[model samples]
Target: MPNILNLQSLLGLAVIVGACWAVSENRRAFPWKLAIGAVLVQAALVLLVFGVPGSAVVLNAITGAVDGLATATRRGTQFIFGYLAGGEQPYVVQNQPALFVFAFEVLPLILVISALSALLWHWKILKWITRGFGLLFQRTMGLGGASALAVAANIFLGMIESPIVIRAYLDKLTRSEVFLMMVVGLATVAGSTMVAYATILGPVLPNAAGHVLVASIVSAPAGILLARIIIPETPGEGGAHADYDSDLKYDSAIDAIVKGTADGLMVVLNISAVLIVFVALVALVNVMLGGFWLFDGPVTVERVLGWLFAPVAWLIGVEWSEAGRAGWLLGVKLTLTEFVAFIELGNIPAGEMSERTRMLMTYAVCGFANIGSVGITVTGLSVLMPERRQMVLDMVWKALFAGFLATLMSAAVVGALPGAVFGT
Candidate 1:
């Protein structure tokens, strides 16, 4: 029998869900039945992708695309590093290896991927895929068309940008619908950032891109589940009925590339800046905590967080020895942001974590679910729908929980699957 009594996992799920419920306006009317059904559906989908052979093949195809991207990124790194392995490696290359690989080589590749994604969207490739996935969510989850589109868009776009697809519907979206949209946005990842994260974790874990891609897809339903739990979809005034207009005219493919590349650059810069400030703050907290003359020595914020989340790490099938390390990563992600946690995870010494733990952590931490994103969601959504600004604020906490749970659900699914399914 599978070891499923991972208390830390269960507790982590509970903490997020409970936080949402505690703060939600409609907490009393949370749709427990619908929430349960959505979780079941997400679980079923995970099992299909990781346990069934045919679904595994399809998943592998998606993973293959990500791996190909990673390989391309590796080649780009080699170009910048001037063949480190082929000749006498420079001292900088030897001591601070992969630094340039991450900053110059891998990060820029995300812009290329973003441009490629825009081209695909312009050509209707991603539209069809998103539509098919949207239909499945609409039928199974019974979400409105706008909600479905938002959720589907998350598979390809970022939290702030995905809502643009349903921009016309933003002002009139029901409270529950808006909440769902926010949840999905936080739950999934933008295609452009996925490549960057893949590059970040790729050096540490094999098949990192594939695992992150799968994790985002698997988290979709989980987002729905937790959203409904915090604010049940009560039958009320119908959501806004608006059509998506893709009428922004670009001169040509090159024009699209230029525009998209500019946009991706801004995003990358914002991400880098936020990460630097937030990490410094965390370090400051650790320093302050270190001054406290506790029982024997000082305990930093990361250590305390690791202790708090260790049980969850264990529940997710991480080996006992590695649970503390994994828990610290989770703590960092939850309190600060995924980017910082991922960077820290990447910096961990090789062999400190087993492959399974590393893979599960990748899935677990792949989301925009931390405290910072709450502000981003509120500010971005409010700008799009000024009238619903209060609703956006109201749903912010729940959306955070939903997003966190979504990632956990993905990790749990991967943890339960056999390693062969992921080609590990």
Candidate 2:
């Protein structure tokens, strides 16, 4: 394993902060105290999850629970799709690699988790927990009420759904507050997609589910830090409307389930469609580039992306020799979706990279920060606050950079910790 107590990670952290400051809206008006507070909060979460005594026990339990949920989802899929969905085969196995179907075995988890998340929300179970975190963000990060609540809720909700938690206050937010909300939304993953990612990454990383959960949780503060650096809050901004009450509602548990299932269906179909098109396009691109040779091999998209982002990979604590592969994955995550990047990550052969590098890359790519998400965010936020649509469009690209840097900062934090914290 690579050295987890890497001093280069400290340099990476400084470079990230400096990069943000270099493009800051108001360089002289930096929120010094808020920046420190955000880093401290992320450090506390990292220690609690990976360093605290008996954290492994708690993490194992969480992982087991998530795995059990996946099992239950598989059972449902098997009933509907029969042998193709991981059920017993009538004939002898011929192609073991082709046995598992992504549509039948994996996508169903989105439906189940979405329904469960909706049910939990109706029970006010998640709402109260979200409120608790909202208050924490407000108090510790000194964010205005609505931004804090939205950031807190983004840990478990989708980018669009999170802002809906503070929908009523969207128009009331200052320019900086609105940008912060957008940054955090892109920096975190939604609960509905969390299990699917865990299932994909389970073979690559231990406690995969727990790591995905912690990635979202820790990225929130990093998002705040980066967003503040890019767009500092104006003096005497609005803070009186720190309400956490959400306008989202359902008539009953059954209604919530139905709505959630419908939403999940859209998500599943969208993912399926995107993957199909993107993968095909990539193949076509590779075919076009097949004639070109570089380093005594055919030049492909992965190689080009690897060369482009290798520095970023090294900056986030990957070894120089492995940085090319790591950079390709990072580039894919930024240009394509994280789902595609993760699928590629899972395809890498065992022993190809150190455990530390795998863990660092996991944190680095675990977010909704991609070119596609930019349109989704702009359209979603525009519908919620039409009056501020122009402002959102203007600042959203900056928010994307902030979100991207936020995940890298999370990876840098993980890299800075001692190897013993993770038992690597």
Best by TM-score: 2
Record all residue pairs in model 1 with backbone atoms less than 3 Å apart, i.e. clashing. Answer: 6-315, 8-311, 8-312, 9-312
**lDDT of all the models against the reference?**
0.74, 0.88
> Global CA lDDT of candidate 2, please?
0.88
Error of 1 at 342 (Å): 1.6
Question: Per-residue error at 125 for model 2, in Å?
Answer: 0.6
Number of clashes found in candidate 1: 4
Per-candidate TM equals 0.85, 0.97
Per-residue lDDT for 12-78 in model 2, tens only? 8889999999999799988889878888898889889878999988899888988899999999999
Model 1 stretches with alpha carbons more than 4 Å out: 4-33, 54-64, 67-101, 239-251, 293-297, 315-321, 417-424
| Backbone clashes (count) for model 2 | 0
